[model samples]
Target: MKKITFSLACLLIATIGSAQQDTYVPKKTNFFSDVMFGGGLGLNFGNEFTNISVSPTALKPITENFAVGLGAQFNYLKSKGYYESTSYGVNILTTFNPIEMVQLSAELEQLRVNNKIYYPATYVSNDFWNTALFLGAGYTNQNVTVGVRYNVLYKDSNLVYNQAWMPFIRVFF
Candidate 1:
């Protein structure tokens, strides 16, 4: 009789403890409250070659460790008397932070490339669309990220570059 009563008493206490730990509902979140703005700037100069680019991005975190964003890019390149080109594009990017100091990212970009090439005695114009998918990993510190990215869609016939790799630094505020 005593054992039965003790079991019932313990069960009642357990139920009350669980009831006291009920979760509370959180306040509503605003869409822009956590948005971040950032961008990357690029410049390359040589005796006969110059390249400049600007990109602006907006990112929003949907979870503690993941974010998604969109960006726009404008690029201009000139190799004196050889070629002059202008590129404009839009991209979508995603980032995942597995740890506090590491970030992994992916971006899909599409660009319209317009070029003027000067031969010995003639000029040729070419216009086309180029697409690239870049995958990267970086060390992140504060608002800065430094990394190397690989273009998985790079082609030898692409007019922009001969290599498929690029190094980058990104900042956000």
Candidate 2:
């Protein structure tokens, strides 16, 4: 009886000691600092004017899958009954990546218009413009990405909105 009890105690002690001696390794998450440059075209249709825009942007990632960036866009338009004009803007944006190769972004923009018409028979031709908010979604591969965005502009007691389906490609170095 003594021998059996002593052997059981030793076995228990050995099992506990072996368990305590084991080492654990934790999994690691992938993080990256990403810089992206891209360009695309835009089309806008409104009661005042129909325009086409060309834009180029630069972005810097602040986290593994999130980033903040700045952008600039130039627009040109021609209309028979209206004056032609050029417009440009500066914007700040924040982007998020919820999954690999997918990204979502929001932007705040301030635009300046070189020539504009205010209302019927009132040509408020000034370098005045408005602010806008934009939301976008996109996908990226190893070295290329593309996306689309919808934007809304707020003006004097009115809300103007537009959708832009822009496809862009970016190369990372």
Off by over 4 Å in 1: 1-29, 43-50
- Candidate 2 stretches with Cα past 4 Å from truth are 1-34, 41-52, 116-127, 152-173
lDDT of 2 by residue, 1-173 (tens): 99999999999999999999849886664533356776558798887767898877777878888877778988888564666677788888888889989978788888787775446666656666768777778797765657777665544432123233334354444
RMSD of each: 6.3, 9.1
For residues 72-128, could you state the per-residue lDDT of candidate 1 as single tens digits? 999999999999999999999999999989999999999999999999999999999
Q: Which 10 consecutive positions of candidate 2 have the poorest summed lDDT?
A: 157-166
What local distance difference test score does each model get? Answer: 0.93, 0.71
- For TM-score, the strongest prediction is 1
